[model samples]
Target: MDSLLALLKKKSTGQGSFALENIKCDFFISDFDKPLLYTFAPFGEASADTISWGFEFGKNLDVNVIAISLVSNESWYQDPELYELALNLGKLANFSEILGYGGSMGGFGVSVYSNILKIDRLLLLNPFSTLDPNIIPEETRFRWYQRNLEWDSRFNDGAITCSKGVVVYDPLFKLDALQAKRFKDFKLVKLHGVGHQIPMHLNKLGLLKRLVIDFLNNGSDFAWFYKASRNRRFYPGYFAWMQSQENIHLTQRRKATITKCQHSLKKLISSKPGVDSVTGKDIDFIRDLALDNESKDLMKAKMLMEIALKLRPEGEFLKMKVSSYNKRLDGPDL
Candidate 1:
């Protein structure tokens, strides 16, 4: 540890600022003396949900690792201490490389933190810019979530000078204007297969060491990531896509959420739960409706709701949605 940095850390006492407050999270600090890499996935309203980034490379990066997490969908903004804690961790760790990790909403937090934290490299997994006004257009249930993460210019480099940023997401997100050149300065690697999660036995820590070794030796890893098979990019399997969409929908933004189920019948059942409003068909629609809103796919949510009601009866989640679309649909008034 550098003596100057040590002294500075000593002077900075008390609680560190954190994004979430409701729960005390587990903060894992590793290899503090070397450049430190920090990772987090803040789910906001969908905090409890889980998604894998399929990075068999997590352990291969070789740099110091600091993993901090709040509960699922729990707002870090609720507790400024978590922010302070993060900063304090950064200070105390004296990290040369600050890396943020996340996908979906977790991706959004990593981007937002780049402004406040001095980071060197970032591996964002399907990150979202939750607060960007564009989020509203999705009309997915997740578009309207806790007010804290709404995109504010503050996190934008235009407003706040931030470190280099990079994104590793599904191009399907189709977000450019909201973050034009957001990662132009950084190395952006899009994983087509989703690389949602590496197998459990990928020697996490050793792999991380290898990545750091490559980065420090040459400052590049296109070959390294490829050679080590650390960059295996595979998305959710057929059934997983269907489940993931629902999993992602309910966990994060429901509007932008989608259905991975290629089966038309399966999709229909997921999207429509009721048989007839009063006559009652089936609750199968709940599966799709939940998956839609949870994944932030509002359009799908509306579609599923329409089919569900057409088949059976209206329910809680749909009632709220139908009321909004009432002016257009003459089917049944809320």
Candidate 2:
């Protein structure tokens, strides 16, 4: 329990960066003077969680951390006063280095604020370019952000300053890939199999702390990240991605690729049951895949629908699928 965590555990006194309108910033000053790491909160997360994660990652190193939490998905681009206050605090402390780090909504915050804060480096994971549907119509996920688009439209343009940055994301997630591609200046690190939750996956493999520490000491080094991410091959997300690839191969009629993917999926399923559990939607998808494969196995598809219905008895979609399958089975062969 560090002093920052202790303070957060107790209520704030409206003192220095602790209280901001619709935002909360927590500071963890280490015993030794070191580079400052500023982390922004992910969607719907409290500043405490971001601070705790930063403390855990930089605990061994001589690093001071400031974690910012946003009350909503506003992106903080509209708030110039908050940025000014952050800049003043950093100058007051005379920190040796300032780095910004975040993921998802937090990533958006870091991208927008780091420039104003004059951050030396940035480490972002699966960040969104903009929630404005007008700018990015494909970005339909965060509706809350879309509803409250009060900031300057130019703010949603892209990364401004902090030329040196490491953006990590999976190309499989189409929207995240799009966002990562929009960053003209940042160095992209593609972690293929892992979805948007790159930090969680890295943390699970016991490599997140090391990666962050290395990045803090050194700048954006892709080689280190590549070596650290080798363990991702064994992660559940990798297996899930492999299953998706298998579906693609099946659709393409690529027999060799399908066989390889099937073998890999079976092995993964055997080792990781939780990852292999078939849901109603998964079964429906498999049913469609079976039909697309041009297989005359209508009975098998019906059985699958039955299994899906059993899994989710109240699922109207599953019921409709089962009824459709039954109709096809009972209808005259044509």
Extract clashing residue pairs from model 2. none
lDDT of 1 by residue, 42-91 (tens): 45423323322222223344444434455645453333655565465554
Give candidate 1's whole-model lDDT.
0.42
Roughly what TM-score does model 2 have, to 2 decimal places? 0.64
Q: How many times do residue backbones clash in model 2?
A: 0
Q: Which candidate's lDDT is highest?
A: 2
Model 1: how far is 252 from its true place, Å? 30
Per-residue C-alpha lDDT of model 2 across residues 7-31, encoded as one tens digit per residue? 4334222123455566666666653
True lDDT of residue 212, candidate 1: 32
